[model samples]
Structure formats: structure tokens, C-alpha cells
Target: MKYISGIIAILLLSVFAACEDETKTCDSTLLSDLGMNFKKDTLQGFLVKDTIWPKVTLYAIGNDSVLINRQPRSSAFMPLDPLHDTCRFYLQLDSIAIPDTLTFRYKRVPSFVSPGCGFATFFSLDTVITTYNTIDSIHINNREVNSSNDTHISLYFIY
Candidate 1:
């Protein structure tokens, strides 16, 4: 019984040591190679008494063909009501392919009531592509626009 207990304790210690070593392996080089980085902030705001409209589209240019489609994802819009101090929105890419460039197009429509104050906003679009060995590169694009009483459109790209 004593011998068996000792063997069990030794096995447990080995497993714990292996786990500790694994944690240290997450280095910056690995992150960079995988094209991973800390994400920046992008936000946009509009001040209007009525409703607002926003839309986004992403296109991918592959070696074979050109793909143009909607992101098929949901986004949040904050009305900036007096009760709520701030609003939040979340945007994400549906899918991404390797060795390809992506183009983004955005449009917004705003309506105002009393027009006491205009709206202020900022926003960002990011997509990450991964491979079997490592990430080739990370590309990020951002844009901001303010329209008090008219419609607006914005376009940009990331490669």
C-alpha cells in the first residue's frame, strides 16, 4: 500500500509541473506569429430625437473570384435616452479567408426632432484570418462620421 501511494503522488506532481511549464510557453512571438494583438476602440454616436438606421457590408477578393455579401451579423444601437447615460454596439466578422483582401462599406441614416444637440460617434471593423502554422498578418480599419440631419455613407478596406 505504501509503495502504491508513493507512485500516485509522483504521477500527480509530474502532471502539475507539466501544466506550469505550458503556461510560460505563451510568448509574444507566438502571439505575433498568430497575428493576434490587443484590439483598439471604435465608437460612433448620433444625437436625434427619432430613429436611426445603420448598415454594413463586407466583400472578399480571393484568388479565384470576387465575393460581395452582407456580414450576416447583428449590431447594437444606443438611442441615448436621458435615463441611460451611454449606449453600446458590438460588431464582428462572419467569416474570413486566407491570402485575401477585404473591403467594407457602411451607411447611416439619422432623424432629429428638436435638433437641440448633434450626435457624436466612433466605430471600428476588424477581421482575423488563421492558418495551420501561424497567422500571416493582422489588418485593421476604422472610420468615423457625423451627420446631424442628412444621410451619410463611408467606405474603407483592410488587407
Candidate 2:
């Protein structure tokens, strides 16, 4: 009966182990990315090369306040509307240089990445418009935007 008791204890231990929670904390890649470059001429659906601008000023569209005074880099992840279908961004250097306004109309869908991460919104670009100030042009490189470490739009600055 000792062998039978050992087997029972092993089975009970296995059962407890199975009942333990196995889900991991959620962290999702769900942001839409944008890249900037200086374009000498306008091109439809243009892609950015290694031509990164020295400094591109960024602002918040809600309060019209400066977010990054001088973003000395490229590829910034844009915020998406989780409940709405529109998002906007403002870029103004100063009075010397004209400002640019970007408007994005997209389709938002709830993305449930994990239990820990919960739900986040994913966007599919329907249309993108820009105010041609110092910017030469803007184009949507990828319509299906997700958090995939990829660029969705390319902003071409007048060189």
C-alpha cells in the first residue's frame, strides 16, 4: 500500500501545479510609427531614406503646446484614437519657418493583446492630410498600422 500512497501524492502534486495561473503579464506593440525626412520634390507614397532632419519640432494637437521642442531624430510612434477615428499632430519650428499640421483619419479596432496588457486600439489608415508649410509633402507608406516596429507615414520636409 506504500506504492499506492506515493502514486496518490504525486498525482495530487501534479493537480495543484496544473491549477496554478500560467498567464504572463501583457506588453503589446500596438503603436503607429511615423518617420521624417527632407524631400527636395514631392512624390506620392514616398519612402524616407537616410535623410534624417537635424531637428523637427513637435507639438501636441490637443493643447497646441510643444511636446518636443527639437526632436533630433526620426521615427516617432504616434498616438491613436482608441474610441474615435481621427488623430492630429502639429509641427512648428518658429516664426521664421512655417508650421505643419497633420491629420489622420483611420479605422480603430480594439486589440486585446493579453490579460495583463488588456485592450489597446489599433489603427488602419484611411486617409492622411497635411498642411503644406515648410513640409514639401506627406505620404502614407503603410495603411495597416500596428505596433510592429515599422513606419506608417513618411513626412518629407522641403530641402
Candidate 3:
């Protein structure tokens, strides 16, 4: 009976150790999503840095899943594909009939974290392509995107 209790205690300790290790891995490695800030621009070069959209819908090209669905927001975060060097998105603002397309080109740097933890992806912004249907211009704030959720790009809408 003592031997059985000892074995059970060892198994419980092993389980607790595994849970602690998983927690550490999760804390270290996180999904790095690209952050975007919105702004309003006038023809006279007046810039409103923190412009809020009444409603915004966002999704990726070639994917039916919508990332954001008609939400009022001034900033958003979009995930980039670690397997691909480029990602394309379609965004509709304030019930606009025509949606603007944003293409992001980046260099993906994958870091092998551990055997149990797969990898963490970091991105360096290369270029951004946008359809000017509703968007006026784009500004790259930070070229590097990683675990920190900082604004990497800013979108300027013509007022």
C-alpha cells in the first residue's frame, strides 16, 4: 500500500511539473499579430491621428472567415501568415459599398522555441499595397512586428 501511494504521488508530481512547463511555454511564445491604427487625412495635409470608424469589417483574401465584423474601432490587429511572405486583406468602413484591399509584404523570421513548443514568428515589414478606393494613404509606424501588440501600420482615410 505504501509503494502504491508513493507511485501515485510521483505521478501527481509529474502532472504538476508538466502543467508548469506548459504555462512557461505559453507565457514565452505567443501569436504575434500585426497592429493597425486608423487616421483621417485632408487634402490640405491636415492629419487626424486617431480617427475612429463608425463601423468596420475586415477579412482576408481567399479566406471566408471574417476577422472583424462591423465593429466600431480606431485600431485593429490582424494576423500574418507565418508560412507565406505576403498577406492580403479586405476592409470595409462605414457601410461602404466598395471595400479597400491591403496587401502586406513581410519577411518572416521563425524561431524554434522548443520541441514541445513549436515556433514563434517575427516579421519585418517590406512593403504595403493598398487600393485607394476609400483609403488615402498608409504610414508604416514600426517595421518590426513581434509578440508586442504595437501599431505597425497606420491607414489614412480621405476626409
How large is the C-alpha RMSD of every model relative to the true structure? Answer: 21.5, 6.5, 7.1
User: Which candidate has the top score in TM-score?
Assistant: 3
- In candidate 3, position 96 carries an lDDT of 61
| Candidate 1: tens digits of C-alpha lDDT, residues 39-99 | 2222322221221112222222222322223333222221221222222222223333322
Count of clashing pairs, candidate 3: 0
lDDT string, candidate 2, 52-138, tens digits: 445667754775556567665554656665657887888764445777888889898677756666666667889888888777667
Candidate 1 TM-score to native: 0.18
- Model 2 CA lDDT for position 97: 74
For each candidate, the alpha-carbon lDDT, in order, equals: 0.28, 0.66, 0.85
lDDT of 3 at 2: 67
Q: Which candidate order results from sorting by TM-score in descending order?
A: 3, 2, 1
Residue ranges of candidate 3 with Cα displaced over 4 Å: 1-25, 112-118
What is residue 22's positional error in candidate 3, in angstroms? 9.3
TM per candidate: 0.18, 0.68, 0.76
Better of 1 and 2 by TM-score: 2
Candidate 3 structure quality by residue, lDDT tens digits, 11-68:
9999998777553454454668899988887654654667889889999897889999
Task: Per model, state how many residue pairs clash.
Answer: 8, 1, 0
- Which residue pairs in candidate 1 collide? 42-123, 43-122, 43-123, 44-121, 44-122, 45-120, 45-121, 47-119
Error of 1 at 102 (Å): 20
